[model samples]
Structure formats: structure tokens, C-alpha cells
Target: MAVHLSEPDRLLPVPGVRLCAVAAGIRYKDRNDLVLMELAPGSECAAVFTRNAFCAAPVHVARDHLAREAPRYLLINAGNANAGTGQPGMHAALACCAAVAEVGHTRPERVLPFSTGVIGEPLPVERITDVLPAAIQGLNPQGWMAAMRAIMTTDTVGKGISEQVALSGGTVTLTGIAKGSGMVHPDMATMLAYVASDARVESGLLQAMLGRCADQSFNVITVDGDTSTNDACVLAATGASGVAVESTEDRDAFEAALLRVCRYLAQAIVRDGEGATKFVTVRVTGARDAREARVVGMTVAQSPLVKTALFASDPNWGRILAAVGRAGLPELDVDAVTIHLGDVRIVVDGGRAPEYTEQAGQRVMDQAEIMMTIDLGGRGHDQAEVYTCDFSYDYVRINAEYRS
Candidate 1:
């Protein structure tokens, strides 16, 4: 039921990265719930974490470790977010890093820890630490798929992508994986993603690229208008391909490819959203600025009325119009606004278009994928798009019984 999404047939490996997945019994049974990613020495790594004031303990530890030294390994666990446990949570996160360092023969500062799952619970540190040696022993370049599954909590399908971009010197590979289903919104979500490349990139440039790509991808997606404390996105460059992304042309190509992977993963999360029956795209154009456009698009995307209408396959354009009108735009001219559902113009000059018909709107709503465009007249030329999903009966059931 993942809309039009499917698991990747294969994920090409980055030369300087090795991964492994193992069952730690931290939360789930008879399944891998822990993943370890080893990065080559001297690899450049950059990361962005959730801005929530109460971020998870692993986010704090990972940020400190990344600042102190280049990461040699990334330790991740599912089914326990390790957030809201305060000082005790911080110690648990650090203990896991210490265990990884002991087994991998690296400094504790060289390890970054990430966790996702039920919040406000004590992490089973022993469960994860007991499996570190095995995880390291089984590390292989082709463990991308298994790692993707291991890091999932509520995600129904594994989300990942692999691409090869040709530079002037040689071709470099990029592979990324992400997990999320609910508690998703802008400023990051209840998601964790990691992208690795074999191309050589300066540390500063790598961070810049990640921020830009994240703005276009993760930052533009919403599910239920809620953000999580454990959200993070990381980028690692191993330089194993001997391809330098230094030149302007090379930098542009590398960033473009990175954006593609990020966008694909972001959209996949929406397609697999909890109880999602439709993949919805809200595009807001002709705003005063890019930020305004994004704000408006997100407002529409996060509206429960709009989302439930989508789930029911209802051609209720009024829900969308109401959301747009409340987007907090000043001096807004309702008569200048226009809206479209798929290729059908539902609203023109701020009211139902004369040529519009319920049958035509229903035809578009009945599809598994939908696109809604709102034109804010000629206020400006800026535009933005937000990806979301419809809410269904299962969404409520899934969260209501999540702890059970």
C-alpha cells in the first residue's frame, strides 16, 4: 500500500563505505534492528539535525563527535529514539559509541550515534553493545539494503537510491537511505537519512551541498504537521574514486545528483506515509518570495481537511481554498488567486471556474497520485512545492495502538 513506491532493486556501494545489519533485540524480534556504517579514513562527513529544542540524546552526541573528529563509524539503532531521557539518555548514547569504538578500534570521538523509534524510553544499551562486534565482523560494501531495513521503525518499505555521476576526472557513486512514516513535517521529520559518495569533496563544500539539497527535499515534505526530535540527515564523501568535485562544473554536477537522490528518498517517505492512500503534491506559485511560497504550500499540505478529502477521493476544492486563504498572507487579493487539480482548473479568479465540473475533478482525485497547484496571481515569480499524503482510518489506528 505504498502508493507507487517500491524497494530499490539494488543499491550501488560507495567504495570507502562498509555496512552491516544485525538483530539486537532492542525492540523488534526476529529482525535486524541495528545497523553500523564504517567510513574510510580521512573521509569528509557533514550532517544536519532537527532543530527541535528537545532533540534526542544521539543528536547531541553525534554533533559533538562530528565536531571533534572525522567520523570513522556510524552506529544506528531502531525501535528506541533515546529522546526525553535527559542525562541518562546522553550516557546511553555515548555508551553505544564507546562500544563501537572498542570493537572497531577507533576513538570514541570518531563515532556518531543515531537512533529512531518510540520516544521517552530508556535505550537498551546492552542490547546494541552486545551486537557491535558481530555487526563489525559482518560489515560489507553490499549491506546497503539490509541497513536500510534495519534502520526502519514505522516505514513499510525500504527507501534508498544509488546513482553514478561522471566528472571530468572519473565517475563517482552516490547511495543514500532514509526511514520515516509519521510524525513528519518541515524543519526535518521523524526521519533519518544517510548519503555516501566516493567523490572527493571539501568539507565546507560538502556541508553546503547538504544544506541546499535538504532545503529542496526534506525541508519541503509534511505528513501530519508534527516534527520529531530524532530527525537527521548525513553526507559522507570517501574520496575513493579519485574524482575531485572542485571545479565549478564538477561541483554543480555533484550537487545536482545529490539533490536527485535526496528528492527521491523524500518523496518515497510521503508515498509510504502511515495509512496513506494518495501521494499528494501542493505547489504554491506567484508568491512574494520563496519562503512565502513554501509557507503557503505547507499550509495546504498539512491541512487535515485537505488530507482527509484526498483520502476519501472527494473533490472538495473548498478545503484547499480555505487552507490557502488562512496561510497568513497580508494584503492578499482573493480574486487574483487560481487553483488547479491535476490539469483541471478548479478555481479561477478566486472562485470556482466556470468550465469546472465535479466529474472532471473527481477523475483526478480518484488517482493514486495527485497534484494541486495554487497560483497567487502575479504577486511575484517565486514558487515552492510540498509533498504529503492523505490521512486514512489506518493512520489513527496505527498511532493509537503504537505502544501496544
Candidate 2:
């Protein structure tokens, strides 16, 4: 399959990181379904995952392992979700981690496992274990697109991004690949993302920066408001560039480059959301913090009523108002809220703008991309942005036959 290549402005490999993929055939009848990435032993890693109460076995396992001081590898499969399978599900994940550990010559606890596609099924770790030796043998650094296609299930396209960071002595590279187009929400999405960088960063610093980057990147998208069982994003620093990142200046530069790659991939995921024809950006300003602003924006952006109206170009701002009311924030003034659809004014003072016309609003909504801005004219001042798309018939059509 021909994958969508990332634009030149975003095309670059992670410095010092070599990657390769082999067809483990864990669930699919053919094609590669497993990905193994080996990192330098002292590399630092940071991750964020789904908050789903029934998070998959791997999500649970990876969360605990991320607390470790360092990591050496990541193993991901795109077939069985390995979710809601109870205790044995975890055992299966551990076994797979152990297998990869053996191959990487690292402890099982140093490897992280991630799974996506389908729910409530036992993960056949043996399928991955059986072919892991081949994956290990096939490991290289150039097959970025190949690794991307190997991790897709319902996704129709592959998502990847890269960026470069200039260090005092040398340049560092960052690259990431993601697979997710449905069952997206946050506290985390159903997505599985692997990012690698050549800059040597401390574990604590990487974790701190990842948390901040995720708030603005991966956490900024939603497809169905359904968090997945195996959502995760990891950055494995290879120290290949020989840039010793010790001070805050180096950390800041590394985090910025990492965020650049992750943010682009996150947008790509939204653009490729299941059945999405229009990509929308919801920008909420004058809130109280990123948390409140994003909450309000996601509530509005993810509303089926609002999204369907957008799909049909209906220009229904009332749905936006309804969503803001239920966003579970501190006291909000209905009289102080104003919303704009692109450049078209829709709501003013929390009510329909006197100059509002459905025609103008609809015209703006019909565009392939639209922006919704919410302003709170009070001391509640903050901002956040979320990416979403209009819900369409194709979305239902694609997901309905997903597992059939």
C-alpha cells in the first residue's frame, strides 16, 4: 500500500535511532503486524496512555515500566487490542515483553509493549514471539514508512512526522509514527506512537517535557470521544548525536523539536480520522487554564450534534453553547461567552449574534477546514486548542464493518 508521505518541511529521521520492522503476523493473515524498535541501552523514555478503566494489558504493564530509570526497546502489534481480557491479558503482555527482552539483550522490564485493534480478546503473544527473531534480524533505521504500515488496523492511511533540533555542537533529529483514526479521545487516544531522538536527555527531564508536549499534541485530538485500551506515545533518546543535554537550555531545545514532530503527527491523525472529510480546529481562549479550555473545546468539538451539523454545513452554534455549559468547569458566565466560526460571527454574549445569518455561518462551515473560537470575557483567562473533524456517514459506514 502507498502511504501518504510527510511533507518535506516535516521529513527527517530521528538522529542516532535506527528502526526496522518485520511481519510478525500476530493477527492479520498476512503483512507485517508487529514492530520492534531497539534503542541504545541508556536511552531515556517517557510515555502517556489511555485512562480507560479497562485499559489493555499492555497499557497497564507499560505504565508501571515507564516509572523505571531507562528503557531499551518497544514492541507494538496492530491486531488484537489485548484489552478487557482480564489477568491473563496482562500475563500475555508480560510474556511478549519478555520475548523482546531476550532479543534486545535487556531485561523484560526495560521493554514496553503496546497493542491496538479490536477489544476484549486475548492477545496471541506467541504469534509475535514466533516471528520476533526475524524482526530482530531485520532491524534497521531506514524503513520509516514500512514500520508505519505495519501498525495499522482500521486506519486507511499511515501517519508520520519528523523535525530537526540544532544543538551547540551538533544537530539532533526526531521522528515519530502513529496509527489511529477511530476510538480517539483523551486522557489519551487509541493511538500508538513511537518517537525517537538522537539527543541524550535525562529521564526525569524527558518525562516532564513529554507531559507538557502531550498536553498540546496528542491530547489535542478526538474522533469518537472513546479512549482506547492501548494509547501511548514514547520518545526514546538514542544519544547518537553526541549532544550532551545537561542544562535547561539543551532540554528546552530537545523538547521543542520533539514537540514539533509529535504535534505534526497528531494533526495527521486528526486529518485521517475515520470518515473525516473536514478537519476542524477548535481554539478556546479566555478560559482559566489549558485544562478548562480544552475541556470546553473538546466537549463542543466531539459533540455528535455539533459535528454532524458541521458535516452538513448547518452552522448550528447552539450545539456549541450546549457543550460549553456541560464542560464541568468552574463557574462560567453565560452572558460573557462569544463564539466565532472561522471569520463568521455566530454567538455573542452567550446568545445568537444579532448580525448572525445561517447563510454566512453555513458558508464558512462548508470549507474543507474551519475554525471555532470561544472567548470568555472575564478573569477566567487561558487558552487551548483541539483538533477534530465533522462526523459523517462514512465514519459509521467504515466502523460498522471494521471487524467483519
Q: Number of clashes in every candidate structure? A: 0, 4
Q: Mind giving the per-residue lDDT tens digits that candidate 2 earns over 230-313?
A: 788887787777887777777778777878877888887878888888888999998877788888889988999999988898
Which candidate has the top score in TM-score?
1
Q: Each model's C-alpha lDDT?
A: 0.95, 0.81
Q: Relative to the unseen true structure, what is the C-alpha lDDT of residue 114 in candidate 2, on a scale of 0 to 100?
A: 86
> Mind sharing the TM-score for model 1?
0.99
The residue-by-residue lDDT of candidate 1 on 1-404, one tens digit each, is 79999999999989999999999999999999999999999899999999999999999999999998889999999999999999999999999999999999989999999999999999999999998889999999999999999998888999999999999999999999999999999779999999999999999999999999999999999989999999999999999998999999999999999999999999999999999999999999999999999989999999999999999999999999999999999999999999999999999887899999999999999999999999999899999999999999999999998951
| Number of the top lDDT candidate | 1
lDDT for position 345 in model 2 = 80
